[model samples]
Target: MQLDPALPALNQTVLISGPGPFVLLGVPGLVALHAWLSVPVFLLYMAALAGNALLLGRAAADKALRAPMYQLLGLLVATDLVLATSTVPKALAVLWSLSGEISFEACLAQLFVAHVAFIAESSALLAMAVDHYVAILPASALQGTPDRYSVVGIVAVAAVTHGACVMATPVALLQRLPYCGQQALPHTYCEHMGVARLACGDMRPNIWYGLATTLLSPVLT
Candidate 1:
């Protein structure tokens, strides 16, 4: 494919074979504001990281917090850390230095990690709610309370199976489509739909699957 001369010099490179690097146009029309935006965003990232880290450390140190509920909290904290780490640094890079070039593989990996962390986080929250409900039930009504290890194991497995495995389908489908023309993605991160929209061929499968997953995610959770 020939590169479009009308395109900006930055975007003249054609993706002839593989899925090439994408230029992330962070928060479109906010180039001037990126410097201002980065301050609060940086602070928020720091706060989230510090708060979660403190909770994780306290849970590890305190024997009383070794309960199943605290175990779920630990899982939540860890998921949050992964979620933040996956996207925030890249965003900061975009805002601070306009460094938004991301290789195809890296983009897919980012989306995968972000989605897995999200699903895992949701599962942990749901498990915590169930744990609380079970706690309030009469002893006679309960068959057997699940221990902390069991709860953790269940959450981990669900995350790996549902989050990691199920999420791979979209990545694989997206990978099959050819990406050509403009490579500028108008977002801070490589979202499923955002990336799919850039493909050259028919994207019905990608669209329908993404919608199906979005709708079914809550029900599955």
Candidate 2:
């Protein structure tokens, strides 16, 4: 079948590919992620899955952590658990050379959770940074601030960070995405940025934000 003339111009780039295997973070090239790497990845993933599940369950059951920090931690852990579940099997399959065909819906779900966790992790780190800053201001600054004010700031930062990422991810995921081929992730984990790069449209903003958020996380702290 004849392809669109412009199709030939498409390179394996975010802008060119528009959304899947070719878009966003554009699957980290063809470099094998350690030959036969499945066993250890499976073990590690299982351990994390178990641990996060317990932590999430306990957090949900606890009444005391209704406080902001614990609340943030609980929610973040829950998201992380979801992310872990979404990614580990895929990675394991790729390593083991098993079934690698992921459906569009499943890919989207993994993409959403994993990317959400990426942002959440950054925001949590930022909150921690803010807390540290507030807790250790110069003595002169401390004099004016109330004794309990630092804790309030910490809570506020945590809540803000948590809410921001939760809100941001869905907008990016559900909104306007360029179509590509059937979804089959190259890596064991579902990478949103990687998938986005496969879109046949402008992806500069996504790339820029990904870089900006990652770079800013440490500095903000």
Candidate 3:
């Protein structure tokens, strides 16, 4: 494939091993503004962490909040915490200290956790919507009463299974490709496509799978 004239030429000589560390070029155009951007990003991270922590605490402490709906909300909050923690600290490091280096394994792990949390969160939200819908159902119109706990359990299992299976495909695909040329990724976090695009070998499978997951995840949820 021909190199883009608009972009810097890949360093053909310096090939990175599969498990080697990558340089994260966080938002290339905003390099000069990284320091300025770190402030708000830090605040947002703190807010998300604090808010989720409080919600989780409330759910755990209050007996009244032990209902199926609140259980799902707890799952959502937990996933939110996971999602934020998986990427935010690294992002803050990059923005504040320009410490953008990340190991290949670490990158893939981050990608998996972040995406899984996102999918799981969506699933929880959908489950909550279903719960709301069920709340207004007429008693006479219903068949034998559905077990609320069973519904919550099913939703939780489905969310985790879907997230694990869907997100794993791209990680597996990426692992097969040989990474040559530039190791610098132009993102704050280790996104599947962003990392895949840096690989030296054919990454069409990764691209297509990533696109498929991105488009289908919402509809599937």
Candidate 4:
């Protein structure tokens, strides 16, 4: 799609298409309350990003928090901030922008970051499972919910244990894909393996890893 500068470039118009059905039905209600609602959305989003970022910051501040697992969970939460902030607004824009198109390089960038967040969340969930067994198993084998406070205490602990291992593999694999298909993605959300599925070359590794992660998530939990 190389263009010659010899001729005038095509002029394009961009508009907001908004959303369909559910959105159409919902947005007007949202807009009516937009002033109030927007404040909450913004504040809540900032809080999530801020809180997670703080955990990461605290992890760096004290040597005691430098344990391998805490460090890993801190990394995961730090990344969650990046995902919540960097990707969500652009995604909303992509849905609204009339062009509804993204550059291939941009798409790949989104794929990498978005998948990392997903993996971190998955790893976090798994860590929850490990904590679940330890914290839920009562001292007398008949204790109630109060006995599970230890699991709640160790949420960060478990997240890091699994996150370290999970983060390592994907960080390597994501940067290596060569995109050779049509530049368009059918859906707006940037999904790593789905995009990889459209790749012209074999994606056996991606498919295998995806299945393995899915199975391991539930099994390990």
Point out the higher-scoring one by TM-score: 1 or 2: 1
Residue 95, model 3: Cα distance from true site in angstroms: 0.5
TM-score of each: 0.90, 0.56, 0.90, 0.47
lDDT of 3 by residue, 137-197 (tens): 8877567867878889898899988899998888898898887755788889999988888
lDDT of 3: 0.86
Deviation in Å, model 2, residue 161 alpha carbon: 6.7
* Residue 164, model 3: Cα distance from true site in angstroms: 0.6
lDDT of each: 0.86, 0.58, 0.86, 0.54
* Residue pairs clashing, model 1: none
Compared with the true structure, the alpha-carbon lDDT of candidate 2 equals 0.58
Kindly list the per-residue Cα lDDT of model 1 for residues 1-221, writing each as its tens digit. 67677887646644455675998888988888988999999999999999999999999999999988898888889999999999999999998875899999999999999998998888888888888888898878876766646867787688657788768998999889987655789988889999998888899999899899889989977
In order of listing, the candidates' clash counts read 0, 16, 0, 0
Which parts of model 1 are misplaced by more than 4 Å?
1-15, 144-148
Error of 4 at 47 (Å): 9.1
Task: Name the better of 3 and 4 by TM-score.
Answer: 3
